[model samples]
Target: MELLLAVIPPLLCYVIFSLCKIGFQKRDQRCYMLSYQCHKAPEDQKLDTGSCADIVTRNKNLGIEEYRFLLRTMVSSGIGEETYCPKNVIDGREESATHMDAVSEMDGIIFQTLDKLFAKTGVSPSEIDIIVSSVSLFSPAPSLTARLINRYRMREDVKAFNLSGMGCSASVVAIDLVKQLFRTCKNSLAIVVSTESMGPNWYSGKDKSMMLSNILFRTGGCSMLLTNNRALKNKALLELTCSVRTHIGSIDEAYRSCIQVEDDLGHKGFRLTRDLPKAGAKALAMNLRVLLPKVLPPLEMLRYVITYYRNKIMKRSSPKGAGPGLDLKSGIDHFCVHPGGRAIIDEVGKSLALSDYDLEPARMALYRFGNTSSGGLWYVLGYMEAKKRLKKGDKILMISLGAGFKCNNCVWKVLKDLDDTNVWQDCIDHYPPSTIGNPFSAKFDWINDESMDFARREDYLPLLKKHSR
Candidate 1:
């Protein structure tokens, strides 16, 4: 048949592309699953401490500016509202709080979100065979993963480990690790948590060169479940087609572009000295080099072959960063870019050629919650769920960039209708409607006709001019 003949060549190209993913050097800069963590809190706020006495105790100790800024950002940002603070129960001093307590305050939110994720995945905590958590800050006795295993009191055979100091890219890098584990085993379940302890990591010093990272990053977390069994794959939550990682050399400038340290003013934090947009583009180019075989059909490649060559010769840099360098937009039905900052999201949107509608969730997440770092994607995903934009077989592409000059991504296809109208949804209704600058409205008073002035803000896409750097 004519249709059959037409499909064969494209299918063949996909098969070849799939094969190319088998081997790749893992590259991750710390985002979606990779980046930073939250602020520093005292003993009372550790996951083990669940007393109002504790949050209040610690809240009082927090600097006024810090508390005011965080409250404004997290409260107004449209990320889901939930057990804002989940703490561990130690000796019942605080009976039962949230997992927020036991999470060592490395930014307690990541794990709390994961608990909801567990419920969404429909996999019992007991059903999980492995627990792998990555957070750049915090160490807990009976690690956070162990607490989950204990809370479920599942089988004693569950494998658990905690990893930190790895950049934000660890989630996919961690998933890749789990993939190898499941490949060697059968019917095993792995839960990977990627979060950043950003609350404590915010840079607060006179080092103007390093403070940029702080301005961009916010607080958030993301979790993923991976399984190798074909049986499980049939009923899996999200089917990951594959993943790719690529890295540029991690030089001093790149390293210091986003470095963690205690500032001269005694404010210890992480900073960014990057023109990060450029770095992100470079990594994307490299990933595409390896990704060509998997998604591009030979016929599609034929169309691209000319286009690719034409760009190589015909144009260099336009006023807007334009003329075909990587079309991240078409490759994904939805995107959950890190709510790193307003500028970051704007740059990402412009570079990828995404429309305002396509970037609504990311901007809303930033406006709503500040940046929850590793958890940022989940908040954006929460927005998508509120809109019910996800359907089975819908493919979502996520990309994160961070410290090691790293970049990594995952492509997920929904296997079923995710019951997203959960706690986060209830929380979102509390905020003002978010739009282009105030996509999620500002909680405080706004000047008259502010939204009109705000419309001009939409044109603030920084990476619009190619070769501007």
Candidate 2:
């Protein structure tokens, strides 16, 4: 009788303990996003075509060929005139950008974003248990997270992480980091700030490959509040479901595809080699290979497998120009692709066989904000919210490509129907404009005439001024 009593009690206790552990694990894994704020620089910082042309004309390093190349790239870049740049760039002092300039640029954006996010979420700085800040081009001595802690006077024991050189994919990577931390830290709140310092990293060199970034990247940032606290579920906007990251940096070509290096003349710049597109495509394929199985419906996976085998048996390749290789629509409701460039957005849309509606947020964001590096994805998300496309039970797939030849993807499930226009509020009505064509092409087509001496074209000033309006 005594032996039976002891054994039965211990066994029952063990089972209860195991069940409790499992429940706690599941709870810890649940991460919720409360709100996000995207920074919009003041109107004075906007870079229209006329201002860009004026800056180019003042640059002594650019020759006629370089001017024409910049014009061509700008026209085809899909970025609109209202995109913002660093104050230093606007002042025509990019080459002389100091550490203070970089710090000032980041301070303006990050502080404004964090302040707005705190106000939106009503979350005090003291409540933030962890901080993760990612800035690819500039890392200062105090560190960005430290700057936040100092400015906001956060908790003394809070965990802070600063990520540098991760490129445009850094935001997703930061989210992934927070997800992992949530698994260990019970009921914690995290803040993620994503931005790039454009002032110090501006390319002054004449290398065509290195100069593309000058036209594409602009000044922007975003701050997000994420929490694993179940008590705050009612206030959450999106729930983190799955995250996948693929890095192909082991390959030499991929590693060198996008790098910051000094040119032959010792002028530092970020070089985008011809191999970048190839590297991005490969990384994306590898990432999706792992992610699709996790998020796709079972029926979709089965159909894909059956199709593959049937194609093999028939000795035929899949039909040409088929909608995505697999029906991702069966799983994902919306796509928030990185607006790295027009080509990148188009390529992702084609590969996934996404409809024009699915790609509109990305295209519109690109036209509105240019590429804000890691912060760009939030702009796309904001556009979707402004358009009121996200609904409860909808799943959004976010894909981000960056240097280190990395592809990072994550899935978020909407908790509620969110309609905050955020940064796109001012111009949301004008978006998906009648046309996204660059007015620069029409006004500056005369620059392509090789017969004219661009350097000595003072006579063309009147024409430039007339068309600038």
Candidate 3:
């Protein structure tokens, strides 16, 4: 036993050290993260690595797009609400369906998003040294992260980390995590994917506080790549400028804002609170403080001090949240604020004093993809990418909230231009423009045919009863 123990520890250490060597060697040349762009079976359909290499070698012309987006690819579970209609709600003699059933139905937003990512980035799993992803709300039995790791048959040595977000701002939080690991490390690849389970996570109870959640939050997600290798720096995907993390204490009053937990009172499932707007505001203030060290320029810091005293001595002019002269806009040219809710968006917009154009990507994302939670930022980036607004040197600011009662932000440096040639560029043709208000609805269909959980859905009564919205 002693001999075995000694041998194992040394062996493990050697393996880890060896992995570090490989990690750095592949740093920047790693393949892209797959988004839901192409369902066509790759040359290696059931065999993951074969397809991965195919993807890696296939996207040679991707970055050639006319515009450039700094951070990463946008993704989501295809929204379930795109098919719902408000007029149908009023005329509804039909059931008030729940989203659980439709969870795995066709055109799943998540699948397509992953496809888009793979097609655009031209990355495959075999090429990745690490897999880092997160989803808030929906969790499959075997776990999606594990499924991906296994599906890709990633290098047996590949490192994997999957997270379930408990707060509203967690998507960018995942980005922060990915950025930290990639900065000190190299060659190793990190795929930061964020998503929400709006379908299954939805509330059906009459609790007014909880009822509000049903009114807000839509489906969406985002996926981005990170590598410290020098080879990939010329196109500069996103730079890990810095990050700020802040959390607020949770209490009943505060709780009413963002949770839908199954509490003591036979709480069937899901709930919402009305105070989310204020809670989000409070959280954002803390995150802003955290985000400062990264975005604050020395000149701006000096100006902030000057503004603080000037406002105090003037005895009348007081800035609303953070003190005066702290111009985040001056520090970055783009914004990807999470579109959690209209109120939340209004709050962030007002607090940052960002103009409509500055928030156009965010609003447009919300209009198109809904509140994909953590992954929502990618959608906004795609908007910028599609619009060809991002330039080689432009900076983008991404911020989000999460169920953990936290707020987070990430900064990106545009690398190459957004080439219209990427496979996903044509997808825009399928979606309606930003003007179509109420462009989303939530529904869950029975997936007995498409899923392995057929037994679970066979007992249809309870499942349908659960959908009694």
Candidate 4:
């Protein structure tokens, strides 16, 4: 009887404690991006047409005509002079590419950024519940995720995922994975490390299609920390609302559009077919059809429904092309469209009916950092925050396209003022440059273009006023 009395009192105390913990704690399982940073390579590695030609000359497979094609592509690429490459390539040294070079690039980017993020958020590595690392070109023996785990000395039991070959959409895909994991494991923190290494992937071949990668891709990376802990609400910059992913790889043309291949001479390069932009558009449309209705306000959805029926009725009288436009801008305030290339950005902007101001961050990111693969979207977001255009309660949509002919979108609601103490600090002042484009350039006179009518232009101002409250 004495032993039963002792056990009953302790059991009652434990029940009371459990009840208090569950009742008082906030159980918002939504993930938040606490912080992120993008890597900046050295200045000497920045390549122009002449510098690219110098490297092309080293490859016996390329000729003068191919060199001229690269130069022409560069003219329309929207890439400026600040993007970077490896040290040996910039120094004109003939060092054989090694796994260490790619590992070094990943180390420099992943460790530095993760370090800063940890410091900014005051979250230790041991506290991290999951770590996801993604890279396209190089997947070594140990894996980048394993490297991060060892470097940070994270807990042995912490889950780690290493993603390879996912291309530029890999990071967002990682976020999707994290979201699902957080739904199951509450009060968890995850780190997403995004990077691409050009050391081994550099094309030494003459295939014009493959050579496009050399002209556009640059050295850049981003590391972001995500958490499901409600205690981190104040520190988080944005809250994840929804994520959508679409892959058109089942289509033969789309599957072949962006792929890594070996030329006849045995030189490896990533091949980009002409159908890439169309494939990207299709994938984006597919993803948005599923994603938009979930996030769009009721009025916006009704308007789209009305437009759809009106278009169906008009199809009898007009060309069958007068269908309902996506009208995404009506629901989203800021956009971080992947600056994959000038063509991709232009295609996405036109498809979404985005304004010049809406695309400024993407254009500026392309100009400043070139296409850093999955990392480019973060740079675009950084550009917007650096410009002080983002505000609390604003909604942001980030879109990325990858080699699988994949389109992924993540919708986020701003939680707090942006934390820009790292990546944007050095060059943010020079961005959205004073002289952007000429009268004939695509950037100019876009605001008044008839194509933008689908954005519901007249309602933009009123919508902003409504959101401001």
Best lDDT goes to which candidate? 2
- TM-score: the better of candidates 1 and 2: 2
Which regions of candidate 4 fall more than 4 Å away from where they truly are? 1-28, 48-50, 93-95, 316-326, 419-421, 434-469
lDDT of 1 by residue, 1-469 (tens): 9999999999999988776654321211111121112222233422211221223223222333342343344333333322122223222323233344435544355546556666655667777787788776666677767766766686898888787765666666677667666554556777777776543343434454444443344445666666655555555556666678887746555555555676666656565555556776677667657764565456566666777777679874344766244454445588878776766777777767777788887877765555655556667777777677888777787766665677777776677665554434544564436433321123222212334343332232221111112
TM-score for each candidate, following the candidate numbering: 0.66, 0.95, 0.67, 0.84
Count of clashing pairs, candidate 1: 62
Quantify how close model 4 is to the true structure by its C-alpha RMSD in Å. 12.0
Per-residue C-alpha lDDT of model 3 across residues 219-257, encoded as one tens digit per residue: 445556666556665644556565677777565555555
Report the poorest 10 consecutive residues by lDDT, candidate 3. Answer: 66-75
| Candidate 4: tens digits of C-alpha lDDT, residues 1-469 | 9999989999999999998877654355578888887787666777654455456556655444554465557667888756777665666642367667667767877887888778877889999999888887778888778888888888989998888899989989999999988867878989998888876677767899998998788888898889988887887899999899999999999999999998888878899999988898899889988989988888889886887789788883433333336566667899899988888888888777788898888998888788999888998998888888778988899999998889999899998766463566887777767864322123222434455455552443333223222
Backbone clash total for model 3 is 59
What tens-digit string does per-residue lDDT give for candidate 2 at 360-400? 99999999999999999999999999999999999999999
- Best by the TM-score measure: 2
Question: Would you list the rank order by lDDT, best first?
Answer: 2, 4, 1, 3
TM-score of 4: 0.84
